[model samples]
Target: MKPSFFSQYWCMVSQGWKADLADKERLITPLLFAITVLLLFNFCFEEVSKGIEGQVFTAELYLTTLFALQMSYVRIFVPDQQDKVFSLLQSYPLNYSAWFLSKYTLALLYSLLVFVPVMLLCGLFFSGADLNIWSAELWLGGLLSIIGLSTLGILLSTLTLKASGREMLFPLLYFPLAVPVLLASVQASLSFLTSVPGGWHWMGILAGFDIIYFTLGVLLFGELVTAV
Candidate 1:
């Protein structure tokens, strides 16, 4: 009898976690890069006017997240590829949707791991003593954007898995497609920080993008993997 989808998904997620944990650098490298970039920005802009500083800080935060997330994206398939596990998986009549979900879940968790610490550190660096940065609205915007980005990342990673010069190809492909999500994320974050109206509008856009990317991922991932 075949394992149920949930069981398979849980198993895949477990394996992915184990693989990530085993090679701790896969998670730590991007995080260190993010912090380094943030520190560089802070040092360079420490003297900027307070009014412009917030805007600059917001841009830096999202840009750092984007760069770090993209760095992590390539590793989504690396463990399976290196271990030839994809071949074994292909031999089974397993559900690719579950596989995609497991990968997507891993990507989401990985992004969160990179995001939360950066967020806290960003707040500490950029926020006023009276400013409360961890509002419910900010969390909603960040999570929704991460969801959309992770979905797209999985699809794109799968698409480029077997391509020549994929290292060169991924950023060429990922950043342009991710512009909408990144923009919405930045705008939503600004709205939340400034207590401005229309924060929901940006979050709604992020949600819409997430649905579209996830739907495409589910429909196309199996075909792509089988072709590899």
Candidate 2:
């Protein structure tokens, strides 16, 4: 029997999700990096705790989480192209747009999987800070950031597929493109931390970025995939 369209798309997402979970090296690297960064911040900032304001530790933690999520997108797509698996998947019955969206969905879900626990742990360590400000707006902003980053990553992954030095190329390409999202996220996060009323505008900016990038990605990705 033929699979339904939704079933086929979800199968693509599930395959991507499982591929991520099963790759212990790829999976653990980000988590360890995040923990190490957090611990280093904790120790490094110990003496300056009194001088620090605005939950600097929490800000660092959020930055670490975002960085890890960005790395995971690299890991997921780069290896698939290296092994020619992405090309094979592209040849399948699923529409290329569905495949792209499925990967985006997987990346977003995987990022949340890593982010939530890290945020909670950071909350525990930084007592007296109202971590409860992780509000609906914050969630929306995060999702937008993820969408924007993942779209960009997908585009770059295709571009760098055959480069001999893609590992180096990935960060060089990713970080510059990611600047806007990171800035918007930081602003939104600061608004959340400060209990400011106008923070939602930052979230709106993030949402707008997501919409613009996702649309651009969908349009540009066909050319990207076919170019190689």
Candidate 3:
């Protein structure tokens, strides 16, 4: 009998996690890239107004993390696609929803691994531990953005698997669909930084979109990899 969905999901995530760890080069490069971008943003914004600077910081962080997420998942399907392993896997008596969630979980874990550490370094040292910068708002906003980015990453990965010139086509396909997530992440940070009233609305939008994205991926993943 096939393992339960949770069991299979965890098994897949753990294997992917171990593989990523073994490939330290892949992890180091993107992490270094995130740290470098954070440092540059910190220096650039040092002399700006604190209140509005918060808005700019939020926007910059959101955009940078979005790009990093895209890069991290760029080769998400390389193993299965290149080797055609997915076809064989599909023949197993497994719940494919676990497959979608496993990939999403792995990507989200990597995205947060890159994004959070850099943001923390910037927040504590570069920003002098500003109160507004270290609040639940920033972390919560980041969590939402990560969730959205995870599912979106997987969806985009499958979509571009067989397409020509994927390098050019990925961001073209990814960014437009992710505009809402980017906006919500920025606005949520801005609202928290400025103590504005409307950040909850953006948070709600993020939560809704995360649910929608995950649902679609889970429901359609079987077809998505079949060249949809």
Error of 3 at 16 (Å): 1.2
Cα lDDT, model 3, residue 148: 88
Tens digit per residue, CA lDDT, model 1, 118-184? 8888888866633348789888888988898898889889999989999889989999999999989
lDDT of 3 at 155: 87
Best by lDDT: 1
How should the candidates be ordered by lDDT, best one leading? 1, 3, 2
lDDT of 2 by residue, 1-228 (tens): 666768877888887767766776887777777777777877777643433444584477568876787677776674475567877866767666776777778766767767766666566566665444556766666666777777777777667766778889988888888778777877887677667777788878887877888898778777777777
lDDT of 1: 0.87
Query: By TM-score, is 2 or 3 better?
Result: 3
What Cα-based lDDT does every candidate model obtain? Answer: 0.87, 0.72, 0.78
Q: Between candidates 2 and 3, which one is better according to lDDT? A: 3
Candidate 2 has an lDDT of 0.72
State every prediction's TM-score relative to the real structure. Answer: 0.96, 0.86, 0.89
Q: Clashing residue pairs in candidate 1, if any?
A: none
Model 1, position 108, has a per-residue lDDT of: 97
Model 3 lDDT, full chain set: 0.78
